[model samples]
Target chain A: MAEIIGGYFTSHVPAIGGAIQRGDQQTPYWKPFFDGFPRVHEWLAKTQPDVAVVFSNDHGLNFFLDKMPTFAVGAAAEYQNEDEGWGLPLYKPFKGHPELSWHVIEQLVADEFDPVTCQEMLVDHAISIPMELAYPSVAEWPVRLVPIGINTVQHPLPSAKRCLALGRSVHKALASWPGAERVVVIGTGGLSHQLDGERAGFMNPEYDRFCLDHLASDPDALTRQSIHEMVRLAGTQGVEVLNWIAARGALGPAAREIHRNYHLPISNTAAATVLLEPACGVWALRRRSPRP
Target chain B: MPTPPRPGARPEPIPGTTLFDGDAARKGYHLNAMCYSFNRKENREAFLADEEAYCRRFHLTAEQRRAVAKRDVLGMIAAGGNIYYLAKLAGIFGLNVQDVGAMQTGRTVEAFRQFLLDQAKGA
Candidate 1:
């Protein structure tokens, strides 16, 4: 069976792409944000995951309001990134794990979580920027990809509970897949920053830290708040933390924090990255126990 | 301590924020559709060549056209624009997030950048 290694949560601001394009990682304005990733790099080096299942929200690159899926999974042979009209350099296509994707799709349906399965998909900065941050300057990515998109753009979004359920279902699917691949689950976007309305520059470090702490120690506590409350506390766009919550859910009931970094104002957003390792024995034991 | 919110009650309005609910989606569909076209380089170039013509192709509302013409970020939002799509339109004019932030907040670009930096002190 495929082994689920852990979960990585990070922000996916498009400006990070431009900062990389202009070689600004060492500059003071960007150094703090860039500093968060080296430890992530070290962890990736140690774990050596063969596949990455990414949870991120689309920012008008792949799906628009025409037909938005609450949850979508990519089963394409290759996922491409294109110009989002933001002038970030296009990244090379990422190879996909179709067999695993189909397995996940099948499991999701069986688990009663219907997700749109796309044989062709275009990933925007949400996926591309994080991939660049993870495997910088790679001509070809090292790991096969699985892109899962959660709708955060429009209102009437799937509830926080629903997103968590989606992640748990994904965890179940990965555990049952008949493969030897080592998998790392990645959730991208938000620590809190709003970029629309008069609240264009909103950032709540208090809420961000609370979320980071709870995400690692008590993710269910984070979900107790309603979507409206989340938007209010985190900000309009900051609600992308739903992706992070879903990613954490994939780690199962218990996870140990490997490393975490949080910084303010990465292009009008609070930026953060966290590495979580599932507590293998505890999780396995809990799974074996009967439901309450 | 604040009182706990009633379940299913309408959330308190967030000041200076607008939720992109279904109403906004319906109102801004054409405008957002036009901005979405900017994802293609040719569409961006065409919009740049004749802003009026491009806006017409999408059948944007008069208010949306005015907002686009004035480069009013806040006005666009009021006209039902979602920031994600409006960002692409902003890109056509070489406006980064900071620029748009400054524009919406009525601050100079440098001031807005400083405000963002100031957020760290509280963190």
Candidate 2:
């Protein structure tokens, strides 16, 4: 039976994508931010998980108010990026693992998550920016993807508790899959910053550090936050931390933190990344030696 | 003008500001749909070509049209425009999210940026 091996979380900021597009990585302003990702690249090179389950929120690319699902699973063979009003030059198509997607959807529904499945989805910067940040391959991305678009734009977003439960459901689904392939679940958004109203440009490094310090040992502490508290403390878009809760839940309570990085003022947002490994000795450990 | 409550539901304001609930969505439907059209290059060009004509074509309300005309980010929000869609319109004027943010907060762009830097350094 398949089991979730690991999890990763990071921010998906368009400015980072913009910096890369303009070849500004070596520039003084962006060098430190760019410097942080090589460690992630090294992780990807070592573990090389076959599939990545990316949990991200769209800014405004694919689903408009016409029909926005709280949880959307893309089961397409190929996912393309839509021009999100202004032309973001780095838009590119990502290959999707439809077989794994369909299976995950089946298991999620069985577990009562009821995700809306899309055969055709135009991913926006939310998905592309992170893909580029982690993989950065000139050719196709190194890992096959299963894009799970979470709703953070619209009100009535899934609560942090619900998001955590949803992540647990996804982990159960992956563990039940018949394939022996290694899979990595990723949550992409937020380390506390807001982008709207008079309270815009809000950043709380203390809040961010508190959350990060507890992510591995006490994720439930983060889950206890109400949206009102989240808004007051982290800003509106800062609610995207629900994605991180969900990602952490997928790895179960035994997940061990392997890496972490945090930075601020990444285009009016505090950005963070954490890598985790499951402690059951089931996935990564089993790979090292045959299970006795 | 206060909108009448819907048949079975009433819209509640988000604690801090106006919520982008169903009522706001309805009130700003045309305004937002018009903004969404800016995703295309030609639509952006057409809007730049004759702003009034474009606003009229979208049947934007006087308040919304005036807000758009003056590039008042906060006014547009007050007129029920969601920021995501409003961002498309902001883009046509070469204003980034941070610029629109500064306008909403009544700060100059440089001041707002400095404020961000300060906040990062703050307690």
Candidate 3:
């Protein structure tokens, strides 16, 4: 039986990559936010997990309005990186653990989550940037990728509770798999930041802090809050808060915040990351060691 | 092996039926953006409650507003938003992405796949 070793929370901000690509972290706008993520940089260096279940939203690359899957799970052996002309460098295509992916799909569906299983999906910033951020260039990626897409591009994205429920289902899927393994489930996107419409470039660090605290301790409290208020505070695109639920939910009723960070660069996002370890089983070994 | 397309290949604009071609995409954007933006039962109800004000913000006509207010995403989209924006709108509205496609082209899988491929090519 496999155990849920831990979970990661991340913000998939394209602007961060843009700044990295420009190599201008020292610029007034980006310095503080980048400074906040040292623990993450240190953590990835230490306890690198075997597989990462990545949840992100598509930017009209793979699933468009024509045929959107509310929740798309990659059952394919591999996924192609569609060049959206982002000019962000690409690497060898990310490999998918179809065996594990298929098992999780089968179990999640059987668990009544109704996951949309696909033979293939393309890599977009939703999955791409997070991949770059997690498995940095200097280090080779040891973890197999399971790309789960949330329909954040459109309205009525899955509720935070639903994404959390999906996370619980993913945990169930992992628990029943008959294999030797460690797992890291990641929920990417949002903590009260919006980009688009008249309310563009919105950031609410206060709300973001509240969201992080709740994620570590009382997420259901945040889940019970009204969507209008979430939008009002987090921005309309802020509904991506649901993706955070998936990560929080995978942590389940028993998990601890190993480390957490939040920063709003006064740019395009309210960035944050929380590292969680399951309340039981080998958590001590998973505590992020000091960086080399 | 080719099958015939869906019963309604393309929506024929009805006088009062709305889902007009000229404003379909923008209407779709507004409709779906609202969906993704508001998910709570109350937020959804509030958006639906002040349909006219929201429509006015988007500058939609009474009929186009009605299409979305009625939850006719296919009709609202068929009127004229970019399919990508339409897809986003559909997601926000609590409608399944594929169902929105189905609603637009009558759910012929082949037709929907073609729509996706064509979109990829255009991009």
* Per-prediction TM-score to the true structure, in the order listed: 0.95, 0.91, 0.68
Q: Score the docking of each candidate (DockQ).
A: 0.71, 0.42, 0.03
Q: Find the 10 residues in a row with the least total lDDT in model 2 chain A.
A: A281-290
* lDDT of each candidate versus the true structure: 0.90, 0.80, 0.63
Model 3's DockQ score: 0.03
Model 3 residue B57 CA deviation (Å) reads: 28
- How far residue B49's Cα lies from its native spot in candidate 3, in Å, is 44
Alpha-carbon lDDT of model 2: 0.80
Which is the leading candidate under TM-score? 1
Better of 1 and 2 by TM-score: 1
Model 3 lDDT tens row, B1-123: 899895434433222122222244344555444433342345445655785665676565555677666766544544443333444344445443334544544545455445433422221
Candidates in descending DockQ order? 1, 2, 3
| Tens digits of per-residue lDDT for model 1, B1-123 | 999885545567889998998888999999999988888999998998998998999999999999999999999999999899999999888888999999999999999999999999999
Off by over 4 Å in 3: A85-87, A281-292, B1-26, B29-123
lDDT string, candidate 3, A1-292, tens digits: 5546677877776666667778867787677666656777677667667888888887666764557678989978788775433334554477789999998888788878887888888877666666666665645567778888887655445666777788878877886677876778888878665433323344666677677777866778777755545667676556677777876676556677888766654334567777887774353243333346
